[model samples]
Target: MTDLNKLSLAEARDALRDGDVTSVELTEACLKAIDAADVLNAFVHKTPEIALERAKAADERIKAGDAPAMCGLPIGIKDLFCTKGVPSQAASKILDGFKPEYESTVSQQLADAGAVMLGKLNMDEFAMGSSNETSVYGNVVNPWRRGNDDAQLTPGGSSGGSASAVAADLCLAATGTDTGGSIRQPAAFTGITGIKPTYGRCSRWGIVAFASSLDQAGPMTKNVRDAAIMLEAMCGHDPKDSTSAELAVPNFEAMLTGDIKGKKIGIPKEYRMDGMPAEIEKLWADGAEMLRDAGAEIVDISLPHTKYALPAYYVIAPAEASSNLARYDGVRYGRRAQLAQGDGITEMYEKTRAEGFGHEVQRRVMVGTYVLSAGFYDAYYNRARKVRTLIKKDFEDVFAAGVDAILTPATPSAAFGLGEMTEADPVQMYLNDVFTVTVNLAGLPGISVPAGLDGQGLPLGLQLIGRPWEEGDLLNTAYALENAAGFVAKPGKWW
Candidate 1:
């Protein structure tokens, strides 16, 4: 069999069901690819023993004719997910050596579906940065490069490693969490499909918190079909998480009819930012045209509050991050700094935090604390919350007007060289999520599909925003876009 690692999740699932391959064989293929691709720094942890054991069990289940859609599929878990007995650090030093005794609800759900866990993928420290530079495990190099240029590019953040691993065929698919474009941005950078389901679509029970309200787990895969399949396996209501939606998980994979005729796709005017690159602008127009050719009506819509999405996200996310990250004061688990003579409890807390958190994490925590302070609470945090409400309402009004999905550029540009933007003003980096944060703010389902290549020969993606609880319809629309774009280009295997 040719490289089983290169097969998409849906293809592998069909092969496994037809008895054309064994789980061990597929797992070995991924393990071999991962071992040879360490230059990417995607897989932070290697779990060969656990992977082989699970693959063996999956083979048995397949033989017994009881395999699920994700059965025997090898996948990478983001570091933010707490896997039982496996290092689950959120790419932060504070969580060093912190392996949970229990599994995260999403991973547990995948395990129950017989998906084999390959290892933990790298991410931004506590999912803070957009470039993945804040990761304690170091930067995840993008597999794609500018034409004939050897400069290493970032795979985009928080979910950078997951994007890289899937794009490089190190694994069939991986789990990614989006707070502010964490999943969609990385997927766009690496030319994969990533969808952030409606808030509470997947249980957040054991995942590390970045911003509780905005953070959500979703699947990053090679195509829309694979995304649909993996998403079905990853979603379900969990009593353990109060925020989880108490609704039935639909058969997303089966919903991919690719016939989106009469679907009203909105083109929001606010996304057409000033001085936007000609390539991104052209790509957005091409995407709208493609959807129009696919029989969907392209309507121009107004989301007047789009300009405030980034500022609101920065404020709200950090504010929640400040409150959620207060647990790591050397009081419970994970790393603890050694104390000096006469050091009191307060000193320990300060010293431990200063040492454990990275620069970006510290900056966000400080900003969060400042916004939540008594004097500035109303000026910053409260006002941002009100803006978030308007953003949500903007989407509601559009949907109420019969817009089925909205189209926009996934990122302002294609992936940039590593360290190119890190040293610049931090706001430059936050702008990476300009087109993506609005979907998260509205708690709606959004997907990024590889659309076309930029002038540099790097991949660019088109995003589709759908109504809440309509991921099935969203995936079907993404499937239509994927088919129209015909984005089969892969990174030239530099890693």
Candidate 2:
């Protein structure tokens, strides 16, 4: 039999239904893979007992003819999702030893559909960094390498672990949250399919907060079809989350007809960053041509405010982050610093926070606090908000002009070595999100599909942004691009 861990989520689903495999067997295969891939640091928490229990229940459901699409499937839950009795740290020391008594809405939904939980995947500490370097568990190494250099490369972030786990076949699929390109960027870097649904599409009830307005949850999988199948199970209305959409969830997999004839795919002129690798430019053009051959009209369009998106996103996301993260003081759940005899509340607060947050997270929180300060509020935060509105308007204008979706390169380039980009300029790291932040700011759906490999044999991906509240259509479009690209390259396992 083929490696059970290598089967796509959809393939595993069918296999279970046909009695070719059992959830227990599939779960054991995944656990074995996880044990072997521990060097990657993809999973920060391991829960084999819980996984086996869930698998047994799933097998029972299947035997009773009560199975759903996700029944008998093993999946990795992002640490951001609060699973009852499971450590739900957001890969941060601030959340050390914190486990929610209740399950997150999204994970709860997947569990209700009979999905087996493998464990918690690592992520950016407080979901702040572009690379997984900010994670307290250590950086997650991308399985892909450049010409066998053996230099460690980041799997992008803050969904780095989810992307890494799926690409390495550690799990069939994993849940990921995107706040200013967390999901798509990592997916691109890891050579997998990841979709960030519209801002309100997935409830953020129990996932750790990043930038409130920009955070969204979606599925990361090996193929577009698997993404569609898992995504359908991940989304729905939840009264617990105020941002949850009231609309009915559609059967996204059934919408993949592969016929995108006459669909208008917009090509943003500004994504061609100066000095970008010629390979990236060529891949973008090649992706466009592939879609064009698939009968979609390719038209060049300008998102005039594209240049301001990063600046605005940096300001706005941090501002919200500062406010949202204020709740993590030592008074509540999670870790607390040891108090000295003379320590006051202020001292405890300072000591706990300083000890808890990592460097990158501290930097963002300070920047956020500064922007929201009285002296700089208008100069920084307010202006950035205005720019955000303009950026959203830019996409709205393009969509209003009859574009069904916009296509662009998912990342500026292939995966970079873990320490390649220096800390002398954090902007270098921030620039990684330049292509993907606009989608989050506009509250639109975006997907990254592995498209090709670079000259060094590392994978590259193409991104598609769709209008709000149209994920089924967006996913169908991704299906077309996925079929056109026929990208089946997997990162050779060296970890």
Candidate 3:
């Protein structure tokens, strides 16, 4: 049973192929694990019947020699990814009772490649918060703990549940969408590896749009090789999504070499901000040293527009979210509050929205609407977009200067106490994404690998930001760092 929990997707597949284990056995093992770890609330919905049925089918396919790449592997789909006949809430009350008649392009693509869906995992309501605390379903606590400290710590959000589930071995790997650090941050918090591919690398067709322009779907798993395998299955061109890249997907799993010799890795000078936690700073330095020892050239590069990225992303993401969420006005899909005695159609729409959206989401919607309004449009929304261009330009300039990739900390600090953030102001919470958001704004590929642990023993993540559509290179570097860090242990501190 313990070995079942520790099995990688490759191991599980090999077991199935060798007849050492059956798909049903693997699926049942995961179901048992999910039931055992119920306190985590990692899964919002568990369709054991569906999962078993899928596993049985996979078993038959294997017998018939018709298996696909991920033949019998079970994966956790984030609730943000719409699943046909399965509730896809984005962890928001506003989207409650919303079940798409269609599957998200990415989810469908994975299913097409033969991966089994365990269930939908939890997330920050509408993918808004930095910590999972903002979830309407309640916080998903980290499965690790300090020596004597028993307080629950945050598994990073909006993809927190995906990270937690993968880390806890509730599922082999899980799908997570990144809009400003959603995937990588949670992966870091949970002491796992996750990647946010270049924007538009994965189709966002049926994904609940948080910040459409910034959103990119990726995989979260225990190791870089697993991430590479899952990511290969996840990426492709989709006619359903116009923004989906037409580029051919690479065989990422085949390219995971331990070699880094002669690779030009850049250390961005701007990311080394003041007040950075000492442990994180040390981890960055140590990571650079590891690459140097591996015979890779580490050069210092500058991204001058770094300071402006956080403010610009906050403005732009909210602005886009406001426009995207306006469709849920009580008439179409999603929940609708019962009308009061005197309420008309417009009043019904007003009442439904007020009752459905949570506090943080409401605040964001208001900010988004206010910024896009006639008078404030130029001052807030447009100006933020201009800054976004400058941030992208910074990356372009650095890349042109002969830097292959840039390295930085995935988050400003390690995962904070769940309630520690709620007590502070919203800007403080937003600042957590300071280092990760710039890559999203610049439309570049970024990934987080377990770097080291802080003095408190919480895991730290080192981020590698790559040029647009250069996920292969980013994953290669992350593979190197993953070996260097040697921190593949699961969440040891249980809340």
Which is the leading candidate under lDDT? 1
Which digits, one per residue and each the tens of the lDDT, describe model 1 over residues 291-311?
Answer: 999999999999999999999
Q: How well does candidate 2 match the true structure in TM-score terms?
A: 0.99
TM-score-sorted candidate list, best first: 1, 2, 3
Residues 169-283, model 2: lDDT tens digits: 9999999999988999999998999999998889999989989899999999998999899999999998988888899989999999988999999999999899989999999
Model 1 — which ten-residue stretch has the worst lDDT? 419-428
Regions more than 4 Å wrong, model 3: 493-495
Q: Give me the runs in candidate 1 sitting further than 4 Å from their true place.
A: none
Q: What's the residue-level lDDT of 395 in candidate 1? A: 95
Evaluate all candidate structures by whole-model CA lDDT and list the values in order: 0.95, 0.93, 0.88
lDDT of 3 at 434: 89
State model 3's lDDT: 0.88
Clashing pairs in 2: none
TM-score of each: 0.99, 0.99, 0.98
Clash pairs, model 1 backbone = none
The C-alpha stretches of model 2 lying farther than 4 A from their native spots are none
Query: Which should have the higher TM-score, number 2 or number 3?
Result: 2
